[model samples]
Target: MGFEEDALLAESGLIIAPDPESARLTRTITGTDQTGAARDIRIVEERPLTIFLNSREIVTTMTIGDFPDYLALGFLKNQGMLRPGENVTAIDYDDELETIVVRTDQPTDFEEKLAKKTRTSGCAVGTVFGDMMEGLEGLTLPATPVRTSWLYALARTINTMPSLYLEAGAIHGTVLCREDRPLVYMEDVGRHNAVDKVAGYMVATGTDAADKILYTTGRLTSEMVIKTALMGIPVLASRSGFTAWGVEIARDVGLTLIGRMRGERFMCVSGEERLVRDADPAAVAAEDPRSRRKGSRD
Candidate 1:
């Protein structure tokens, strides 16, 4: 199936753009099963996602479309380009070129921020760590923990979620939730951009992540871990996997990390105590303790 391009939101909830002109493209075909029997394809859209800083073009990203604003803020946060307390002055979109302008309190120096580009297993983007430890301290999140058992449940349920990924297989999905129920489900070509969309949507709708759970379809990377931490979300889950630094950061900030969530099982790389595990009722009720209940990993 061909991937769909994004268009402006109309009266309806969904919109598709007109056939665009020729542009550069990139992709990688992934083998899903260990036996190489199962196959899943990935079409990477490394298109330019430009962000203008206070009306001046500062960055252009090769990413998928949804959540451009959140992607912008996430970019600024990592570069130490913006502070959490700084109110976003304005956001303007240019439909013609698909460019976004992000306005903030004061002008910033883009050169120094760009010098910290680092490569990842996924991609070589950029990163910065000035005052990161101090910044983590400023986040005041709710004491409520996202139970680990709930992590398994939520991870399973997320696969069956009503999201764009279920419709468009090419896109990576990002969701923001409170406990078990998800509120925002956004999709993009890049996992990073999907996350940014959640942040942007939450910001636009005045939703707080203090007690929320952030879920993604992509592997948990250090960039994602920090983004969720800055948003004040206590938990992060992914059906895929995680990088070493991603787990370390989550542990340092007292964050719960759940991954490889298949139906009833999940890998708890950090904050395992947060899960509330209970015996399977069907199994306990029956003679066999191994009697498993049927479930769909959403």
Candidate 2:
């Protein structure tokens, strides 16, 4: 399909989408199959990306090395290192050093916060510094109504879209959607990185998240719930299951949490009141077998 046609197929217009064909993102390696036959397979590449906030080195993450700027910005933003309405003067990246530095108009320091890092369950060893719920106090997400129809449509469109996860099995995807239309699709070695990339995009583009839906291929964990709430997005859906803490946080923060979204079936653990059951499950098309990913049935 042509670019426009592909865009229309994925319902991703003008916004960022995964480029699985990019050489820098993946590499071909020789391996043996179950039959012991020699085969060549493409594997997603993970590299260290050190992020610096002004003069302090914040943290280093393992990522697929695409949209480094967005990842850097989003990481800082979600971590509360970069405050809302904070002026970002420049974002400088060094390809050779695999480091990205986000420079704000004012100098910043987070030595104490960095000292209290908590390892998360995300693949590639995700880390969250300080209290996991630091910035969520007194935070209230918009009470945006999510249509069942939009959820179904978004699932079909996003699952079938060409993505790094489908291209290489090791990756995870996080999509920012406005109702049924996906705006930005991001993928990385860690789902947190994908979330941060979308967060960064929203920060850079000045996109409002009060009405947006976050669709992810990873499990609905507390980290995911916290990040979605911090981004000001009302809805978070996934094709995977949820963690108890994740559900609890969603309930506390009043964020809609939907999981196990596949083949016209989903479970909303929190914020079910906001769901408008406008779509009939019988009328929704069954998930295509070709669209199945690693955790589609989980």
For model 1 the local lDDT of residue 130 reads 48
lDDT values of the candidates?
Answer: 0.61, 0.88
Clashes of 2: 0
Tell me the lDDT of model 1 at 146. 60
lDDT of 2 at 281: 98
Native-referenced Cα lDDT, model 2 = 0.88
Error of 2 at 58 (Å): 0.8
Instruction: State residue 91's C-alpha deviation in candidate 1, in Å.
Output: 1.1
| Per-model TM values vs. the true structure | 0.70, 0.94
Model 1: per-residue Cα lDDT at residue 19: 15
lDDT of 2 by residue, 1-298 (tens): 3324434544446557668798989999999999999999999998999999988899889888988988999999999998766799888999999999999987786778888989998777789998999988998888999999999999998888888778878888999998888888999989999999999887877777888999999999999999999999999999999999999999999999999999879999999999999999999888879778656868
